[model samples]
Target: MTHITVDLPETVFSALRKTPDEFAQEMRVAAAIKWYELGQISQSKAAEIAGLSRAEFINALFRYQVSPCQYTEAELARELSDAD
Candidate 1:
């Protein structure tokens, strides 16, 4: 796996009241949420990226106000039609 380093102002930690590890974890969760919401990645992939279990990721989505569903209106209609 490839690792990337990010440089932050020293005051950022103090300002955010987060330790380096805590901040890094938050960044991972935020990235996962954004990618998942944008439909760039599947929920399982996002969960992996966020270092969370699938259930945990679903909870995170609720906390972050991101819907778990990614279906479009037409897709929903088709699904409903198929169900009937």
Candidate 2:
């Protein structure tokens, strides 16, 4: 595993009420979710990046208020029509 280091003010942890470890975990998940939302990465790739299982990542989507589906309206319509 590769390790990345970032520097932040000590107050940042207290502001978020998280320990450094917890903050690190949250940062990873936040980045993964944002990237997934932006369509820069697939859900599975985001989950892997966040160190979460696929199911857990889907649940995290709800917590982050991001849609788990990556489909556009047109794609969804096509899929529905194909299913019929």
Candidate 3:
């Protein structure tokens, strides 16, 4: 695993009510979620990046108000119609 350091304003921690470690974990999860939402990474890869299981990542997606499935409205509609 690679280690990276990020410096942030002290106010950021206080504003989010998160300790540095907590903030780091949240950052990982957030990045993974955004990448997954963007279709830049698979769910398994995103979960690995977030240090979470696939199920946990799905839960995080819901928590962040992001869809777990990477499908557009048009694609979903076409899929539904095809199922008929």
Candidate 4:
């Protein structure tokens, strides 16, 4: 894995000191979920970015109330047709 450094405000770092790793992990998960919600990335890519396996990421999405499914209009139409 490539290592990158992020500079956080002293106050933010101080607050994160109690559980820095957990804080960072939560932030990554939130960012990944937000990106996926905005259709900016696929579920697998978002999961990778969140440092979670696909199933774990999907579960996280449910825990966070973020839907993991993407449904386009055409896809919805196809589903409706298949139901007929």
Candidate 5:
């Protein structure tokens, strides 16, 4: 894997340093979940951003109570009609 370096404020780095890698991983997962919740990104893209497999990301969604599937009102109505 390739490594990339990013510069953050010293205080930010210091705060991040307090947590172990596992904590960082969980934070990434949570951020991905929030992004999905906000309709800011697709589930596949969120999984990639979180450095997790699609299955793992779906699991995180379950853990965070974020639905993997989202639909507009029109789409929901269409689905309901199709069910009849």
Candidate 6:
């Protein structure tokens, strides 16, 4: 994995009350959530990017108010019909 360094104001960390490592982890989770919401990545990929387990990522989706499933109403109905 390529590492990129981000320089932020000391006050930013103080204001957020998080250590640099903690902030970095939060950033990763935020990025993963955004990518998942945008339909740019699968849940597993998002979890990997966030350094979280699949179940953790699903919980994060709920926390972030993002839909876990990508299916539309019509697609969901079609799938349900097929399952029967």
Q: Give the number of the best model, judged by TM-score.
A: 2
Clashing pairs in 4: none
Better of 1 and 6 by TM-score: 1
Q: What do the candidate models score in CA lDDT, each in turn?
A: 0.95, 0.98, 0.96, 0.88, 0.82, 0.92
- TM-scores of the models, in the given order? 0.91, 0.94, 0.88, 0.74, 0.67, 0.84
Question: How well does candidate 5 score on lDDT at residue 40?
Answer: 92
Q: What digit string (tens of lDDT, one per residue) describes model 6 on residues 1-84?
A: 889898888887778999989999989999999998888999999999999999999998898899899888999999999999
Runs of candidate 6 with Cα error greater than 4 angstroms are none
lDDT of 2: 0.98
Winning candidate number (lDDT): 2
Lowest-sum lDDT 10-residue window in model 2: 1-10
Write model 3 residue lDDT over 1-84, tens digit each, in one string. Answer: 799989899999999999989999999999999999999999999999999999999999999999998999999999999999
Decreasing TM-score order of the candidates: 2, 1, 3, 6, 4, 5
Estimate the TM-score for candidate 1: 0.91
* Model 5: CA > 4 A from native: 1-19, 79-84
Report how far residue 55 has shifted in candidate 6, in Å.
1.0
lDDT of 1 by residue, 4-76 (tens): 8999988988899999999999899999999999999999999999999999999999999999999989999
List the lowest-lDDT window of 10 residues for candidate 3.
1-10
Tens digits of lDDT, candidate 2, 1-84: 999999999999999999999999999999999999999999999999999999999999999999999899999999999999
Residue 79 alpha-carbon offset, candidate 4, angstroms: 3.9
lDDT ranking from best candidate downward: 2, 3, 1, 6, 4, 5
True-structure lDDT of candidate 4: 0.88
What ranges in model 2 sit over 4 Å off? Answer: none
